[model samples]
Target: MNILQLSNRLGYPPKDGGAIGIYNYTKAYHDLGHDVTVLAMNTKKHFYSLSQLPDSYKSLAKINAINVDSSVSVLGALMNLFSTESYHISRFISKDYDEELKALLQNKEYDIVHLDGLHLSPYVETIRQHSKAKVAMRAHNVEYMIWERVAMNGSIWPKSAYLKLLAKRLKKYEAQRLNVYDMLVAITPEDSKIFKEDGCNIPVTVCPAGLDLDQYKVDKTKIESMSLFHLGALDWVPNQQGIKWFLSEVWPKVNSKFPELKFYIAGRNMPKNLLNMNLQNVEVVGEVESAIDFMNSKSIMLVPLLSGSGMRIKIIEGLALEKSIVTTSIGAEGINYEDGKNLLIANNPDEFVTQIERLIADREMVNDLGANARKLIENEYSNFKLVESLVEEYKKMIV
Candidate 1:
């Protein structure tokens, strides 16, 4: 099959979860003996040079990237206040991108044209006009729901009110655009259900993010049993909020009990405010060269997400590496994980303290949980198995 994957940003050098999600699937389809081409908008924030990618990756997919400035401005925000269009979605609309896409569709016939996320939905009509390909919108998350949750958790009046307005506009935009595609590939069954409830008439399927298992194999001997770590894109509002909550409420209690324990935090785009917080035993390492290496060095992974949607890719990678993890119910959503068996789930400060303490005290329990976590990934979330099923689905869709 000739597959063309459209993305809002370059997926190579998969630094964050979104990048990893896009790159892994593209690689999977290519490895399955399909001709895959990835055309992405290289935004200023997550830009990548196509020439910098390794030859092995280049051989897997015919990747191309075009510059598109997606930065926000004060004037643009004010203008959007009076318009029906979503500021979030509108920012991603570019004439150059549309022309590039139109040219691609005109030049080559494709069996499937997969839109990577909600941001790329604006070009559905363009794809329809130029190509006979089956259009599939890969719904990463109900985009509006993330903002809604953020607004609900926010405190400041004016800022929260503005966020509520954005959420309302985004919800309407998302609902109206649901049936525009031939199919919807949701990242989770939970998200599929929500899309149905929102009146999405298109066929929906669950395709949770899959990982290359061999790359994440566990070597327990290398792990520091005393170290705990939190790794995610800290510039995201939810990560910042969750980390703040952990430091203010949960971390203090845990530190009082185990003062010698060190909690390392690492990720791209660490906010200045979060970097300045003076929390005891909390080390803010801005970013790491390799995610797998960082995970292998830590004994327990912390995913203290207060409000976010979709599966946490880091959680999947952590489990795959056989690292004992403690996360909130929101953090562990979409993944089929059992509490107390594969991982520990905690919602409040008290529960977090209890779960962390349990892992700290019992090495055997941690080992058992980590093993169970890796077993779950091998059986259910293997990249090869998931992508094989996805290829079958593509064949069915084309027919």
Candidate 2:
């Protein structure tokens, strides 16, 4: 089956959370012997550019490189007073890409048109209007909820207030358009429920975020340190808020107990505050080549995510690498890991400190939890299993 996979950003090297999910997913479908092509816009906000895509990508799959304008509009700026969060604007949804996509559909009939992010939904409607393809949308997280979380942050006040208003508007817009697609893929059951509550009429299924286990194999011989690692794209609002919350409330508690605990932070585009806050025991290493390698070296992974939707690939990656994880309930969203069994769930600073102390003091507990976590990921959350479900859904949609 020929699959026209649409993505908000180019999916090579899969740096960010969303990109990583799509990249692995499409690869799995490709492995399943489906003829897959990706049509993506170049957001250009991240590390890689169009040059990152090799000749093979162009030959194997139709890769569309549309340069979209993501700047805030004047109306968006005014909306900021009520809600600082703004919907990402893309001027690159050109008639050219639409015609190109339509032409592809006209030439080679596709069984499924899988749209990756909500940001790419606008184009899905365009495709539906012109092409005879079954449309399915994979909701990473309800964009409105993401905006609500962004607006609810205490770190950035005026911006948060503005985002709150934007969230409401986006919620209404998205809710109205939810039924247009044939199928809706939610990253979590919780998100699926939210979608239903918002009147999404399409068939909703829980499709948790995945990790490339091959890239995250456990290394038993490596000497692990008394270090804690937290990684996310720093530019992302959730990561920014999570780190701040950790630095202010959680990390200080952990530090007060274990001053010698080395806290290593790694992610894309570290903000100035987080970078400058690099203290005696804190190391802010922004953007590493291999996040799994970094996870293997750490004794425990700390995910103090407070406001975020969707499953955390960071937690799953840690599990796959046999790193014991300590995270907030929000951080462990959609992951089927049992708290105190495969992972330690902590919401408050005290709870976080207690978990960290337990993990630090007991080697056996850490080993057991880490091992169980890896087992859970291998059995349930593998990319192979995820793509299988996706394939089944595609067949249903087509039938």
Candidate 3:
């Protein structure tokens, strides 16, 4: 089977959750002997030089990247305020990318044109027009839900109103094009249900972000038994919001309770405020060389996401690495986690403090949770196994 994967950003390094999803799926598809071609948008936010990528990775697909400046501007945001179009989706529309895609479609024959996320929805019609392939969209999140949650929790005045407006527009935009793709692959059954309730007429499959377990290896030697760490793309609004909320509401009490315990925050594009916060017992290691390495070294993984949709890829990786994790319900969305078994859930700051304290005191409980976490990933979220579901769906679509 020949498949073309259209990514919104760089996938090789898989810096963010979205990229990790794309990267894992693509690799799995390739390993399964599918002729996968990756045509990714090298956007300003996740720009990477193709030359920097290794031959081993390049061999997996006929890799191609087009420079797409999918950057938000003040004027564009203001213009969107008047228009009904979603500023979130509109930023990805690029003439350069479209032209390149047009040429690529004309040259190669693919059985499936896989859209990585909502960001690539704009190209569905173009793909339909140029090729005979069935279009399949991977919905990483209920796109509008993220903004709606952000707006609900927003503190600022005009910004909150503006966020609400964006959410409304995005919801409409999503609804209008529900049946555009031949099939919809949701990251969770919960998202699939929402799509069905919201009038998605296309075939929807519950396909969570599956991890390639080989990449995650737990080095028990490096594990810090008394430390806590949070790793994610810091540039993302939800991550920044989560970190801020954690510092203001959750961390203070926990720090006071356990003064010797250190909290390390690491990710790409660290916000200036977070980097310069100078919080005691907190190490702001902005960006690390490898996400898996950083995660392995930490004692407890913290995912304090207040508002974000989609499966937390890092959480899956952490689980695979046998790490004891504590995250809010929102942060733990899409993944099936037992509160006491696989990972601990803490919705509020107090709960977070309690969970952290619990883990710190009981080594046996931490080990039990970590082992259960690895078992969960092994049983359900293995990419080697999950890819078969997606492939079967694609085969059906093609037939």
In angstroms, the error of model 2 at 226 is 1.6
Candidate 2 minimal-lDDT segment of 10 residues? 84-93
lDDT of 2 by residue, 274-393 (tens): 888756678999989887666776788888887888888777777887788889888888888788899999998899899999988999998899889889989988887788877887
How well does each candidate superpose onto the true structure, as a TM-score? Answer: 0.98, 0.92, 0.98
Model 1 clash pairs are none
Off by over 4 Å in 2: 47-51, 54-60, 72-86, 89-96, 155-157
Model 1 bad stretches (over 4 Å): none
Q: How does each model score on lDDT?
A: 0.90, 0.78, 0.90
What's the lDDT for candidate 2? 0.78
lDDT of 1 at 168: 96
Provide C-alpha RMSD values for all models, in order.
1.1, 2.6, 1.0
- Compared to the true structure, candidate 3 yields what TM-score? 0.98
